[model samples]
Target: MVSDRRYCRWPRSSRERTCISSIGPLLQPSSDALEKQFDSWQLRITPVDYLLGVADLTGELMRMCINSVGNGDIDTPFEVSQFLRQVYDGFSFIGNTGPYEVSKKLYTLKQSLAKVENACYALKVRGSEIPKHMLADVFSVKTEMIDQEDGIS
Candidate 1:
């Protein structure tokens, strides 16, 4: 684990988690892959770190799903929908057992999962009716809902 990575004030403790966080897209939101990442990186990932990393992955998944929808790729969003559902389920089990920070991240993760689901729904339901050129515009505007909820610009 690189000692340079920072997360709030838990600097030293977040090293492994920081490494895990960077591998989100590479793992494609798979918990198994996350474990593999810890092994590959020669670091031990705690359940809290793993869950936090997965929570971070959901944000990436949302971006990918929204981009896929704009690009008119139906399959990607569909697969993302399933992946997010699994992540959500796994996270639900954590419930209130996780630390305060994990709870905060989980809240954001839920919002991201919801946005991804909505994007998938649009792709499977209303996507065909919308013109291709207008797809990007629609998704760009709609994805702001996520940005708004997350307080991202």
Candidate 2:
């Protein structure tokens, strides 16, 4: 009699396992499921590519946090901050050994994390003083100040 239980194999390298496991829950699908789906579509992505994509996700999440604030939703920024921090921690495992491209994105990822943290800071500090409708304006001013300080404009 054959048992119905399935034996699964995880990636051999702790790094690959960390990268896949880190991104899995944020994507709302397990890494195994994503792999199966990609396989069915004949798609392939190296671990480096996957890490790069997740790094890029930080920027999108930053935008989302800001948009949530614009809509007067005060809680999402903190949630995004928590998620971004987890992503950042996962990347820390790669450290200086990651590819040059990933290294470059790590700098960007830090910047995105900082922006979200700053937004959350502003909300926590000034939230009580500002009206709900004007919170977006406050975020815009804060972003402008940050951009100017960074010499982006």
Candidate number achieving the greatest lDDT relative to the actual structure: 2
Top TM-score prediction, candidate number: 2
After superposing all C-alphas onto the true structure, candidate 2 shows an RMSD in angstroms of 11.6
Across 66-99, the per-residue lDDT of candidate 1 in tens digits comes to 7766776667666767767887888777777879
- TM-score, structure 2 vs. true: 0.69
- The residue-by-residue lDDT of candidate 2 on 5-109, one tens digit each, is 212222334344332222322233335776677653222446787678777767777887898898988888887798799998988888778899888888778
* lDDT of all predictions: 0.66, 0.73
Screening candidate 1 with a backbone cut-off below 3 angstroms (N, C-alpha, C), the clashing residue pairs are none
Residues forming the 10-long window of minimal summed lDDT in candidate 1? 1-10
Model 1 TM-score, 2 decimals: 0.66
Residue pair clashes in candidate 2:
none
